[model samples]
Target: MSDLTFVLAGPVRHGVRLHAQALGRRTRGAPLVNIEDGALPPGPVHLHFTDRIFGRDALDAAERLAALVGTRPLSVTLHDLPQPSDGASFERRRQGYARVVAGARGVQVSSEHERGLLEQVWGACGDGAMPPVAVVPLPVDRPTRWGPPAGAQGSTDGAVVVLGFVYPGKGHAETLAAMASLSTGVPLVAVGAPSDGHEDLLTELEDEAAAQGRSFVCTGYVTDEDLERWTARAAIPVSAHTHISASGSINRWISAARRPIVTPGAYVGELHRRAPWAVTVAADLPAAIGAALHDPTSTWIREAEWDGAALPDTGTAAAMQLAAIEAIGLA
Candidate 1:
């Protein structure tokens, strides 16, 4: 019989589903089972991102799960508890989050920052009787292999690149402005399209790039294979995000290509606490890029040296998660 069973009540195509799939394959000794809806079979149930699955209906489901499980331990791994885009929705989600926090026997978070956020979210409820939280680094699914080697000299030949979804708060405009302000003309390429209503912002960024005689190209969503090719061609990768919590994109990029990265300072304190290979700078973007170009390998990916919290692959991540569940007395 399987010693652990992960209940991913969320959508089948979600990111957590992928993690569960990879973990199931890597785990040893204890057989692992994954199920969708209906009554959870026997054994402990670890609810994954319940809010994402049930949305406003999350509290009711959480309460039901807690009651149905009886004495069997019920734990939760919070993937995201985002404040809804609007006021009414935010209040509803907040209440739902409180209920889950109070009901679960234990909780798991990816980082210290995440734990602190959860405390702030549910601190006032039930006299702050929140479940104990175990911190574990989130797993990243990296490409099987890096594309052909980028030039070792790290010279961009006067071109700047930022890849990923072009959305508000992703620093797309700021990066373009930074590139334009460079003393030398450096073209900028953003390998993504504006999400939904953000199309105008893309036009604005393109115009800004053109005004400065720098070409800005929006590749409009590329496949994994193409992204790898684009990344390998760049002299330096820009891991720019104004706000993020345990970013999968940044982690994957840093792992796949060992080149130096230009990132926001806030990300340094939160994600890469001990990642000296990453260059964290706020403002003065041109200077930061120049520095990264000079020594691209300064902060090269060293999976073995990630603050003793290295999860180089999915298998290692699965082992860590299994150990955490056992630590909480759930397995």
Candidate 2:
């Protein structure tokens, strides 16, 4: 059997899913099982982002599906927990997982922030029942520079790109506002799946950009090539995750594209303090972004060499979670 099977129950073709697969592959052939929405499994790690939209029936179904995985040292891991959208189902998902994993020791949350989220999730458990939730900081592949080739003039072009699952809370509007204040006519690239909430907001953004004579592109959903395309072309990538633990896309873009980043103080913000390439805008995201955009190459040379290996090459994050489960079982 593989070290762990990471079964993701979602639209399996997305960026997060793909990164999980790549990460799984790197983690000793740990299987990244692609199951339908409710079809879950007991494995070292489970990529669960449960929401009320999936409903109680689906949530209950997921619990049973996990039970069917036969209790082989499970570490049910929820990514981006306290899922920004739903609090109830997120509770159900974690509660259901506690039943499967039983002791707190087997349950592992991927992002450090998830530990508190799990505590809140356990409050829904009532009558005292909670699991041990250890947050393994998500590992990002080392960034590779995708900037211009040797003779490309666009290498010096000024642009600030924000890559993520775009929506109201994602701060797209704020990013645009930041660009307006910058001296350079900043080109902003908004990438990721645009939620319904951002639909009209996006149109307004494009119209404003056209009116202002600024350059902008919004790739609704980016494939792998598109991912590299946006990052390589960007001078700075804006990350304003309102409610998230950690973002795989952010890490991948950071590594593969190697641009300096303007990020909100999310889970692993501390690590960025040590790395020159990253700067956090905890209190004022837009203004922070403006600063970065105005000087994308500010500490370019210095930041270029800065790397925390904050995200190291862990073969499979799932495998590590699995190994933790196995150790738990022995105890």
Reference-based TM-score of each model: 0.74, 0.74
Clashing pairs in 1: 277-299
Model 1 residue 75 lDDT?
72
lDDT of each: 0.62, 0.57
lDDT of 2 by residue, 81-154 (tens): 54436554565566554444353345666665677766665565523656556666566555455344454224
> Roughly what TM-score does model 2 have, to 2 decimal places?
0.74
Clashes of 1: 1
Instruction: State the lDDT of candidate 1 residue by residue for 93-178, as single tens digits.
Output: 66667777676778887766677667767864435567788876666454444433645324545346676668776767777766
Worst 10 residues of 2 by lDDT: 49-58
Name the 10 consecutive residues with the lowest summed lDDT in model 1: 303-312
Residue 223's lDDT within candidate 2 is 79
Task: Report the Cα lDDT for residue 16, model 1.
Answer: 63
Residue 12 displacement in candidate 2 (angstroms):
2.7
